[model samples]
Target: MIDIVYILNQIDGVLYFPILIIVMAVAGLYFTLKTRGVQIRLFVESLRILFEPSGDESSVSSLQAMLVSTASRVGTGNIIGVSTAICLGGPGAVFWMWLMCIIGASSAFIESTLAQIFKRMDNDGNFYGGPAYYIEQGLKKPKIAALFCICLIATYALGFNLLCSYNLQSTFMDYSFYNPATTPMIIGAILAIITGYCLLGGGKRIIKVTNTIVPLMGVSYVIVSLIVILVNYYNIPAMFALIFQNAFDFQSIFAGFAGSCIVYGIKRGLFSNEAGVGSAPNASASATVSHPAKQGLVQTLSVYIDTLLLCTATALMCLSTGVARNAAVSGAPYVQSAIGSVFGTAGPIFITVAMVLFAFTTLLGNLYYVDNALIYLNRKNKPSKRFMNIFYVAAAFIVFIGAIIPMDAAWAMADITMGLMTLINLPACVSLGRIAVDCLKDYEKQKKEGKDPIFDATDIDIDTKMLDTWY
Candidate 1:
């Protein structure tokens, strides 16, 4: 297992770079053009959904759905992840991060919209869909799509689920910043019990918890970052210069201008937000909205919030501090030290808190996604609920194991898995791209003509019966 993990890490480290850039750049450009710049058109409308009450009883409020994703999206990767990028890639990495978000927004919109288009109704009539559903429905390859779905469920539930608990426990124990011990059993037990209780209640319980955590953590992170930026206001121009200079000026730096910056920036950016990757679609598919395009719009806004808003703040904070560029510290410790330089011992403490909250939410969100995938795999109107519960409990144990082992290794494993999933999903999206656009255009026309933009399952261009069916 160790050797395999090491091998996977090496492959992931090399393969993921160019792939990230191509996907983000292409998907961003494609979606932007396809939707006729819906990102701009719905910019205000996206914000409006947050303020307005949800009328749909079956789907979560758009805000709640976003929060479910943000729960995972805003994790330690935003802070420590950003710090690591700038440290290795140089300050210029921030530019690529921002660039991806700008383009990745459209990619987010398209995939999520597709998820909505093929969303399945559970026995309870609740909406459930994601890569698996869309893959089966959109691609007409149930066996291939089922493989991806199982991979997703296994990756999340058996792999990352317990890894999160491990991260949380290690983070809390190491908050002292000196001595830390493995407490996997303790951590696993707590998470397992809590997750079991929540999973039994279904998606709403998971979303409810995520809704509360995501906003609180997001606001706090922003506030902390704002303080760091304000204190080092004078460094702002220099930081900006570093980012642009590194992004394109590779010949100028030790790492070369575009070389490391472009590589690491895109790598970290994709890791942080997962915009073009298919994971976000899982969360987006469940959103109850009158139009598939509405859910797409909502999820698109999330890409902005994750990378542009939350991630950019973390990057700026590290660059502004100057410590991130130092050769000495490295990785999460470097980020903690940078924050400490500004806020003293309290900075690390604050970061640990942020990481705990972010990672915790993300863990829950990912688990929720995996659970849905399992349902798709089982296909029967009535899945064996008990098996799903057992699988999640085991996942929590794995999360605990991942926490103390090594953050970088776990991240690498995650990157590899994520890349594989995206490879399958991106092509699927492009093949079904016209259908997504058609759905969007149809929805828009309906709204303009003073009609509700509801889609009958029968109207889906994709053949539902041809795809994988559980029952």
Candidate 2:
């Protein structure tokens, strides 16, 4: 197992340098150009949509959808992920991360728009959508769509749930100085119970829980980061210079640890916001909104908050205290060190609370991802509740085992799975680009003519029958 993980890590190191970086960044760049800065133009309108009370109470509120997206986005990537990027990529990696977020906003807009456009309502009148639905319904390719759903479920079940739960559990254990041997079992049991309850309640329940949690956690962490930044205000300039120098200075990257740093930074950034990896659209699809473009606008703003706001805050906090520059800086310890510099012994305690919340949100989000994919695979709610129970138990078991593995090994597996998921979705976005553009155009024309830009299921040619069943 260790050897396999080592090999995967080596592969990730080699591939992310140019491959993942170029693919994600270029996709974002292309989408941004294609949309002509639609992300920025629609930002305020999306916020309005998010805050307004929804007419349909059975479906998820817009705020709930945003939180679900946030639940997934604001995990390990904000804390350890940022520290890792800065440590390996130097300070400049943050700039690249920011660039990806900027361009990634467009990618989020396009993908989520497509998801909303092609979503299917199950027999139970609940909505479901993702890469699978878009590929099958919009592209007229069910075989490919089914394959995508299968891969996605595997990624969530076999990859994310285990890693996230383990990380959450470990961070807690570390904070309490508990015995590592016994903690995994306790963590696994608690996660199993919590996730089991949420999954049984369906997507609506997940969204409800996430909406309440994401904002509370996000605001608390941001406030804490602000305090750290103010305390270390003097170190901010040097941190910025180091980041800029390492990112553009090709010479620095080639100098032994420099290249690793660049690769690490970009990898974590991609992992953090999940720009083009296509996961956010799964949550975006279930929203009971008028036009696909509306949800798309909402999703683009989500990427900004995740990468630009949350992830950047974590990066600056670490850099300002020189946590990443030290050889001893690693794991959650790096973040604790940065915060501890200001708060003394209380720093690690704050981070422990933050990480637990972060990991908990991520675990809940991952379970939802798996549940939606299962719905797509089954296409009906009456399939087999028993089967889902088995899947959850198995996932919990894996989480226990995963907590015991070395951090690097666990993280490598996650990257490989995430990268593969991104590769599958990017092409679909490019091919279905016109459909998204048409939806946006139609929406704009209606808005201009003093009409609501609501997308009528009958008007669009796809399959109204599939969508009507949802409402």
Candidate 3:
């Protein structure tokens, strides 16, 4: 009768506290220095390339790829996750979240740039890659690559998707019509059926669905947040002051650093933006950009959009209302109540709708990464139609199971799996950091020459034999 969830939580605590945080911070700083702050220097360039055409109608465009990744990054974590951080760690957590995004964007650039550099083109002329691709191709370690793929599948397809489903369903707990016993199953079934339909259609369908829904939902959510913020305009300045003051409270930092604002902020920030967690690169590699660094830069922009824009909107909307931050008012309920206080009954309704949209798109985006990892694990042999059908059914079944699980268990599972992914990806990125830096230099060198940058594998010192698409 060992409590597995408790053990998972304990392990997650140990992995994240000093170990993952230190490693992630160091990797982010290292990449920032190596690339001379590509995330900042190429900020405008990132926006410029985002709308660049794919050159082929069938290929994924840079904007499409970004939406795919952003779909996953801006899910329940943006709402429920932000609320939880502030509830437990105080408003100061918001400051740490922003700080993490600034540094973590560099790590995002390196991993995504490396993904594009070592990407593989399938027989159908589609591109695919991620940490597993670079780990095997760049580091020349098949075993490690396999390990990373397994972790990626577990994190996204199983753990995170489950949490998304649970969080989405939890939003309904405040409704009068919701029956605790039957409602979860009903909601889960509906979600699973919709998700299965998209998954069965394959990656293109998922891409199309996310590409359309992500933008609409993102803009709508932000508009609502803005309305809430403007309604409480008078409290905005004090909210900012509280966030900064708590962010730098040295006494709290030294007294109980483990439970301090910094830990929760960084943890929630990583979950929200997924900067260095190695997830976004799967989407980054899908884009048909002229230079690998172009897609890299776009993914860096995605990190900013997720944390700086979406997460900030949620944080400000919740805090500016002066909602009570306590264990009793954390997660989805906290968000619903925070917005509810402002808009009355309409507030909770809007939050529920927003959560459904965010979490649904997140489910699709997370599974898209799972598809890429499966491709890598299958050794580039496209999974047979029969196998894919079975896979889709299994994925849908997991969504259903996620709905009935306890919230704490679901979050714990996701955090542990995601932490493992970061641990595996960051080290590999550090080891292969040189290639990404060289690619950036080559890109900048071309930009300075007044030439549109196009990547040539031979332009750098990496083994061209490993680059399937960039030859």
Alpha-carbon lDDT, every model: 0.71, 0.75, 0.88
**For this target, which candidate reaches the highest lDDT against the unseen true structure?**
3
TM-score attained by model 3: 0.95
lDDT of 1: 0.71
Q: Which stretches of candidate 3 lie over 4 Å from their true place?
A: 201-213
When 2 and 3 are scored with lDDT, the better candidate is 3
Model 1: worst 10 consecutive residues (lDDT sum): 462-471
TM-score of each: 0.86, 0.89, 0.95
Evaluate residue 191 in candidate 2 and report its C-alpha lDDT on the 0 to 100 scale: 63
Tens digits of lDDT, candidate 3, 222-290: 998898899999999999999999999989876887667898899999999999899999888888888
1 Cα displacement, candidate 2 (Å): 9.7
Per-residue lDDT tens digits of candidate 1, residues 52-116?
A: 44586555777777766766666767776677678777787888788877777777788888887
Task: List candidate 2 stretches off by more than 4 Å.
Answer: 169-214, 254-261, 324-328, 379-382, 456-471
The model with the greatest TM-score is 3
Name the TM-score of candidate 2.
0.89
Per-candidate RMSD vs. true structure? 4.1, 3.4, 2.1
